[model samples]
Target chain A: MLNSMLEFVPRIPIAEGTEWVTEWLKEKFSVLFDPIKEHLGNFMEFMSEDVLMLIPPIIFIIAVALIAFFISGKKLGLAAFSIVGLWLIYNQGYWDHLMNTVTLVIIASLLSVIIGVPFGILMAKSKIAEAIITPILDFMQTMPAFVYLIPAVAFFGIGMVPGVFASLIFATPPTVRFTNLGIRQVSKELVEASDAFGSTGAQKLFKVQLPMAKATIMAGINQTVMLSLSMVVIASMIGAPGLGREVLSSLQRSNVGTGFVAGVGIVILAIIIDRFTQNMNKKKA
Target chain B: MPVIEAKNLSKVFGKNPKHALKLLDKGLSKEAILKEAGNTVGVNRASFSVEAGEIFVIMGLSGSGKSTLVRLINRLIEPTEGSILIDGEDLARMDKKSLRRVRREKMSMVFQKFALFPLRTILENAEFGLEVQNAPKEERRKKAEKALEMVGLAGYIHQKPGQLSGGMQQRVGLARALANDPEVLLMDEAFSALDPLIRKEMQDELIDLQSSMRKTIIFITHDLDEALRLGDRIALMKDGSIVQIGTPEEILVNPANDYVERFVEDVDRSKVLTAQHIMKRPETVNIEKHGPRVALERMREEGLSSMYVVDSKRNLKGYITADDASAARKNEIGNLEEILKNDIPRVDKETSMHEIFNIIHDSPIPVAVIEDGKLLGIIVRGSVIAALAGDAEVNIENA
Candidate 1:
């Protein structure tokens, strides 16, 4: 009798619900989503495919070294490390993959900052906006990166475009949250002093508030860049090409040596980027 | 005309301010209004006028609405139900653009915390007001440099505000305001955050500055001595309402109520009351017309051993004591000038009573109160003692 009763019991219809919701969103917002998808697709291809290939590998390496030298206060050590790291990646025949990964991370981080900062400023300025955005940011931050990949692929089809969209969603929360916090944390007395001087609203925001909040906003940008880097290997599952793809292939073949080497290369790239961005922040301060 | 005047200024810090204002109109107390409408009355129907070139001080302890009242004058805090007039233009009726123009061109403020931008250099901070006015860069720099020199901060222009001491930062703040060359200055406890020694030095510097600039200034503070020293006229506030408005001498000698009396109870009156306040119309003999016999007769009639000898224009010639007059009488001197002693101590009419202590101690007779080489009055030792001892009946004739 227990077996018979269990056989008749139906499973929850979560899959159908998800599909229906997905189709409903697509139907309702295709005009918005289609243009964004197409523009992002074109921009990603141009950055990763055209720009990386247009510059010679050695010149790119030297340029990176030069940037590192300036950002790190003319430090020979940082410039040497950046040069040696890029050379090692080249020697390992992973230069193209490295550039691809870089392009993806850079594009995603830039888009996150562009969209997130203004929203964050809105949140800081208005209580209603903050209330609405806070929980959405919490969900974006806490959700597993793999869980969103399915939806990303569903929305934009399988490509680097979907990977970038996924990375953008995952990396955006910090910039928004920190920007809001940074503006809010400005000294009340300073704000009052600015207002007392008859500063227009725009002047106060740009001259006083933004300059004061630079360190925090830089911190947010750093987080966004790092989060985009972390999304790379996960993004490889959906035909996004890079060192992440190489690592994924090595993992699939159970080739631990190749996977470890690629992992080390990603680390080297991250260290170089992180040091450069942090030095840039210090210089600004 | 007054530079700034507020008529029945009131500010309630909550919604439903109209209800609180109605209660206030019905003469409800601050607390009663708060209890009735949950509206905190920041300032209550405060009416006062600040004359141009006069240092009008608003003084109160914490939570007494003195700061609020000052901000109301500038429209930084809008009044709930009153009008503020600047040069006969109602601030409440002005549009935002006109208000901004007034803030830029007419008045500037100095903050208690010396609100210099920490990230900006001293020069930049000093030029802040000029920059707000959209002045050209060259003119802004020139004016800022001049103002900084006026404040004795000429060499620290390149340094950031955080690198300077608190007193220096406040000087920069002062320069920032003065750079605008505004018609009025609103200093809200501008020196209250400094060390005691630095605060005293800043006060002396401000007095010096005021002597030359003579800008209409409204100073706010909680200290009685600062108010008395700096204020041309003082408005004492309590519980959001002005308790009294009077000159320093009036406030000290004739406190409006128990609260004001208590506020001034611990004040050092000798330092506050000048020689002009306690001076009397002294007995005198004209040097050109009087002989030793005449001087002696005048001294005897006045029941005094000494008489000041003055010219026809009341120019202080000298003095004649009883011994000198007797010597002159014996010698048959026709003019009192031959026997008059010019060694008597003299003080300006505005010299404080505290300074008179030393003069009166050294002099055998009363100190002569002189102004512009003419004798105004005499500050006797009894009057100094009376002022020091807090004698209420001490004659006070403010110069």
Candidate 2:
């Protein structure tokens, strides 16, 4: 009887409904989406080809190593790791792909921060906003990275822009969540103290909340960068260029050696980015 | 006019504050209102006025609404009903911009937990109030430095609050408030987080600072002893209502209710009671108008061992013992001053019983309570003990 009752309930057409909504949005908002695609695509292209590629790989590697050294308080470990890791990626003939991947991840993470922080602040300030946004954030975080590519392509066509769209959806939640948590976690007495001194809302945010929440926000941004990096291989399916493309082609041909080297390159990049950002947070301490 | 006057100010913590207020007006008790309407009364119809340059303290146990009352004064916690007047300007009715301006110019607060920004240097923390006011950078810096110096933290301006000890951090909190040079200071259990020794030190320093600054202060504490030590007048709260408001001596001497009486029962009375509270009307001899025979006669009539001799203007000259007066009469000394003993201990009328204890222990006679060289009264060992024993009806006229 239970099985018969369960079978009587028809399946919900969630997929069909979602497809209709996506198509309707695409058809109706082409004017808005088109400009964003064109301008954002051009900007990311200029960043990778014109700005980053213009620098000699050796100089870029040395500069990053030096930054790592100073940021890590004259520690030899991170600086040495950066030099060795970049040299290996360079020797493996994936330096251009590395740069392309770097551009995608950096832009995605930066955009996430720009968008996420305000949303986080809004969520922290209002219970209604928090209630509305929390579920959306959860959906973005839990939905498979592949599921976003369809909307990404519909919105931005293909290549690095679409890649950015997909990676942004995947990576933005941490920054928003962390920023909200960080602001909310500030001691009640501190908030009262700020209010008692008659601090304007903006003054309290800048002077007390943001500065106190810096480390937590930094940790969130680090998570965002890592999430963006992880999306690169998936993003390459939409024709986004980078070490992710190399890994994709290698996977298709079953070339284990080539895929392994590309994977190693991504690991090296992740560690370098993670260590640099973590060290920046520690410098304040 | 009072510097800060709160008239029927109340704070109800719940979604339906109007309902809670109605219940409050209906005379529903705090717990009953909370049970019926799910509303907690934070401060219920609290009315008080703080005079300029005086420390007005609000004291209560935890959850008694003293903290909420202090917060309501500055509108950090907005009142659910009634009004607050700052120098006759209605604070509760002011718009946000004007309220912020008042907060910047009129008052600042110190917190129990020393809420210094952990990232900012002590100088930056101290300058926070001025910075909020948009003062010129150099002016803020100078004021912050001077304020820090006043709090004895001038040397630690470059260091962050995390590196400082709790007491020092609280000093920085005090400096931040002082740097604004506000007309009033709101200190909410500011020293409650410190060790007893540091708390005493901070209290002494605050008293020292207050003597010179003379800013109107609204202080909150759960400690009876602290309220007595620091407050010029104290308002005691119980279950979100002010049970009594009076000078520390009046509160100690005549509690308004059983709750207030119980609350102050355990307080160390020696610290609060003074020479004036415990002193007796001194039996005396007019040495300027009367000779040794008169002094001896008065002593015999009073059945006293010694007599405090005062001049026509009531200036304390000295005391003459019965034996000395008799010896003086035998030796033809006409004046009592010739044989008067000048070794008696003299204390000001405001001297605490704590200090009187030390002086009285070594004295053979009663400690003379004098003001400006005139004898007002005398504190005998019996009077001090009687006061400490909570004997409120000690006969000042009998001796």
The prediction achieving the highest TM-score against the true structure is 2
TM-score of 2: 0.84
Error of 2 at B292 (Å): 8.4
Model 1 C-alpha lDDT versus the unseen true structure: 0.87
In model 1, what is the error at residue B354, expressed in angstroms? 12
User: What is candidate 1's TM-score for chain B alone?
Assistant: 0.73
DockQ of model 2 vs. true complex: 0.85
Instruction: List ranges where model 2 is wrong by over 4 Å.
Output: A1-12, B269-399
C-alpha TM-score for every candidate: 0.80, 0.84
Worst 10 residues of 1 chain A by lDDT: A189-198
In model 1, which regions exceed 4 Å deviation?
A1-18, B25-37, B267-399
Candidate 1 lDDT tens digits, B31-123: 887788899999999999999899999999999999999899888888898999999999988888888888888988999998788878999
Q: Residues A10-79, candidate 1, lDDT per residue (tens digit)?
A: 8889999998998888778888778878988888889878999679999999999999988888889999
Best model number under DockQ: 2
RMSD from true fold, candidate 2:
7.6
